[model samples]
Target: ELFQVGQEVEVVVLDFNENEERISLGYKQLTPDPWLSVPQKYQPGTKVTGKVVSLTDFGAFIELEKGVEGLIHISDLTWSKKMVHPKKVLSVGQEVTVQVLEVNVENHRISLGLKQATPHPLELFAQKYNVGSRLKGRVTNLTDFGAFVLVDKDIEGLIHISDISWEKIKHPSEKLKVGQEVEVVLLNIDLEKQKVSLGLKQLEGDIWEDFFHRQKVGDVLKVKIARLVDFGIFVEIMPGIEGVVFNSELDENKIENPAEVFKVGEERLAKIIKMNPANRKISLSFRQAQADLQKKEFQKYLETQSDRLTLGDLLREQFKNLSSKDNSKKEGHHD
Candidate 1:
C-alpha cells in the first residue's frame, strides 16, 4: 500500500563500486525523517490517539502516525495495578488515547502513558474519601499477613492481619475470606507508594479503649485464667483482652510453680495494679485483690462495733499487738 510497482521514486545516492558494478541506494533517506520533527510535534503532556501495534514484556508500542511510534511502559498502562501486561489491557489495532510523557528524537523513542490520558485513580479516590473514611469492599485475595480488598473499581486496599480484628489472629484467612464483603475504615493512603491501608477492626472501635473507659487502676474484677506459664498466669479480664498475673502477685506467700495451683479456665478475683493503654497492657495482682477485700471487711466490722470502742482505743489495740509480736521475736532470738 505504501509503494506502487514501476512508480518513479526519488532516491538518495549512497555508494558506487565501478569494478563490481554495484551501487548502494537509499529510498527512505530521500523522504523526510519522521523523528526529526518528533521533538517539536510530540512534546511532553501532549494528548494523542494511537493504535496498538505490538506488545512486549516491558511495554506496548503505539503507532501514533505513519513512521512515528511511541512506547507505553507497562507501568503507565494503569494507575492502580503495577504488574499488568499490555496484552491484557490492549490488543493490536485497538485505538487508545494516550498522553505523551517523553520524546527522545535522537533515540527515535517517545514515552507514552495510557493512564496519564485520564485522571489518576488514587487522586480520585482521595477526593472521594480520606483517612478514617468508612466504606464497604469485597475481599479479593488473602495472604498470610493481610487481605487485599477491592475498595474501588481500580483501587485495591490492604487490610493487614493486625487490622483484621481486635483479637489476635495467626493469619488473615481466620477473619476474612476471599470474595466476602466487609466494611473497612481507611487507615492510610500512601500516595507515594500508590497503596491504601484499610482496617476492619477500626470499624468495631478499639477494644482497649472501651476497656480503659469502664475500668481503672485498683478496680477488682473476676478474671478467667487463659494460660499458666512458668513465670506468670495470663488471665482474661474481658473478652479478647488478657492481662498477666505475675508469680510475685499470685499470692502474699511466694508460689514456686503456678501450674500446680492455677489451672487454665479457673476464675479468680484480680486487682488492676497497673494499666498502660499505650502498649495495651494491664498488670493484675491476685494477692492485692485479696488484701483489698480483707481491708473492706475489717472496715465493715469496725463500723458495727464503733459504739463499743472509740477511735483512740482501736489505735492502742493495734499498737499493742505489734509490740507483742516484736517482743516475742526478741525473746526467741535470746533462746
Candidate 2:
C-alpha cells in the first residue's frame, strides 16, 4: 500500500511464503462470462454433455465449465422411479451430459434435468421392440415379484416369478443370477405408463403343445415325478409338459401318503387320463394305468403257461404208450 503508482516495487511471490507454500490461489485470472454465452450455447430443453466430477447425497456435481457447475437433483435422475442411491448410477470422475432446465445466476444455481437428457425407457423400448418381442439381456435388479432385465440404457423389463418358468419357481434367484444374461419375451408393454411385462419361459420350447399334439387321453407316456406333496405328485412328461397325479390317482395300497409313493427325480411310466390345454393342466393316472398294463401282462403269462401244460400232457401220454407195450410183451411170454 505504500508503493507509489508509477514506482517499481519488488514483490515476493505469494507461493514462496514459508508458512503455506503448498497453497495456490487464482482470483483475477480472467475468462469469458458463461451467462452471456450460456443463452446461445444451450436453449430450453436443449441437451448438452458435461462431466460428472463429484456426487453428493442430494444430487450430483456436473462440471459445465472448469469453475462452473450445475445441480442435477436426484429427482431428475431418471424417467422411471428414481433410484435410491446416486452411487448406483455414477461414480467419481465420470463424464455425463444433462439438459439445462433453469439458469439462476443471481442465486448461482443451475438446475439440470438428467431425465430429459436421456430418452424415457418406455419410449425407446416401444420404438425398438414390439409386444411379444424376444430379447436377451442381463439381470440388473430383483424384487419380490420380479426382476428387471437391462435391455438397453433407457429400457428395462420385469420378469415376474410366474413368468420365469412354466415349471413352478420356488424363487427367482433359483432360476437366474443378478448378472446372468437370459432370453426373455416381452409379454405386455405400456408406453403411456412406461411399463413392460416380460416372460422368461417363453424363450424355451413349449412342451405342452407337443404333449397335446402327440399324445391323447388313454395314451401311456413315461414321466418323471418332479415333486411330491400331500395332495398329489407332480410328474414332468417333457420339458414344459407336466401332470398332476392326484392322491386318488395313486393306489392307496401302494402309497400311504402321495409323498411316500413318489420322490423327486424319480422316473415312472404314466398314462394321461385327462388333459386341459386351456388351463395348461394334465391329470395323470399312475395306478389305473399300471393296473391295466399288469392285467395285460398277466393274461399273456397265463396263456403261455396253458400252452406249456398242454405240451407236457402230450409227452406223458406218449410215455404211457411205451410202458403199456412192455407189459403186453411180458403177458405174451407167460402165455
Candidate 3:
C-alpha cells in the first residue's frame, strides 16, 4: 500500500539495523517452525501420499506438506526393476504413496521408499515358485552370458549360457532366441537380492543316462568324425553324444598325423574304452576294436583246425612215414 494514501496494515518488527538505518519486517515468522513437529507427524515406516515436486538423478522430491518434503531414492523405487534415473519411474506432479524410511531431525531430511508401501514381488515369487519347480516361460532378452526369461508377468529369471544345454555352446543365442517359448526349471531364488536363476537343460531328461544304458565298455559302435584336433578326434556316436578318440588310440599302427588318418564325416568302428558319467564324457578306441576283431578271427581259425584233425589219424600217418624211412636205409645197406 502507498504511504501517501495512509493505508492501514499489520506488521511485526524482525530486526532494527541502527548502523544502516533499516528495519527488516517479518510476517511469516509469527508462526513456529513446522520442522520441530515434523518427526512426530511423519515417523519412520509411516505411509503417506505426496505429490512429486521435483526430480533429481539420485531421487525424487515429494512435497508432503506446504513446507515439508521427503526424498525417495532411486533404489527405493522398485523391488525388481533396475532404474537408471528417477524420471524413468516418476514425474513431476505425480502423486505417489511412499513409506518414510528415516526421519533425520538433525539434518531436517525425510527418507522415503516407494516400494516398501506394497508387498515385495520377490517374496511373492518365492511363495509361488520353489526350487526344482518346472515352469514355462518366454525368452525376453538375450545377452552374451545368458538369456532373461519372463517366468511371470514383470518377473524375469536368468538362464545362464552354461545352463542352456548339456552340450557346450558359445552363446545363449545358439540354443535360444528372443520370444521363444521354453520350459525351465527353477534353480534358485534369492529373496534378499531379488534374483532368480533358471535352467533350461534341467527340464529335459538326462541324455547321458540313456546313452549309458544303451552302451557299455567294449561295445563297438559306428561313429562319424565330427572334429579333429592335435591331441584327439571327436566322433559323434549318436545325436548329441560325442566320444573322443585320442591320437594314441586312433590306429593300431603309429599315426604321424591324426588329420591325415581321420577325416571329417568319415565313419569308423570304435569301441568304448572308458566312460565318465559324472563328467558326461566318453572315450573310444579304434585300435582296441581292431585288436578285438583280429583275436576273434584267430580263435575261429583254431576251432576250424580242431574240427578237421583227429588224434588216431595223426598217429597212423606218423608210423607209415617212419617205416618208409627204415626200408630205404636197409636197401642202401644191401647195395
Residue 320 of model 3 has an lDDT of 94
Q: All models: lDDT?
A: 0.91, 0.80, 0.88
Best by TM-score: 1
lDDT tens readout by residue for model 3, 177-246? 8999999999999888888999988777777898988888989999999999878999988766799999
Pull out the clashing pairs in model 3.
none
* Cα RMSDs, all models: 11.8, 11.7, 8.1
Q: Pairing residues by index, what is the TM-score of model 3?
A: 0.67
Off by over 4 Å in 1: 31-60, 73-76, 79-111, 227-231, 294-335
Tell me which of candidates 2 and 3 scores higher on TM-score. Answer: 3
* Reference-based TM-score, model 2: 0.57
Clashes in model 1: which pairs? none
Residue 279 accuracy (lDDT) in model 2:
89
Off by over 4 Å in 2: 1-74, 77-119, 222-234, 238-240, 252-269, 313-335
**Compared with the true structure, what per-residue lDDT tens digits does model 1 show for residues 1-335?**
66799998888889999999999998878778888888888899999999999999999999998899999999999876558988899999999999999988878889999999998788889999979999999999999989999999889999999888877788998888999999999999988898899999888788889999999999999999999877898998876799999999999998777788889889999999999999999999999999999999999998978855787798899999999999999999999
Q: Give the CA lDDT, 0 to 100, for residue 153 in model 1.
A: 86
Give all TM-scores, in the order shown: 0.73, 0.57, 0.67
Best by lDDT: 1
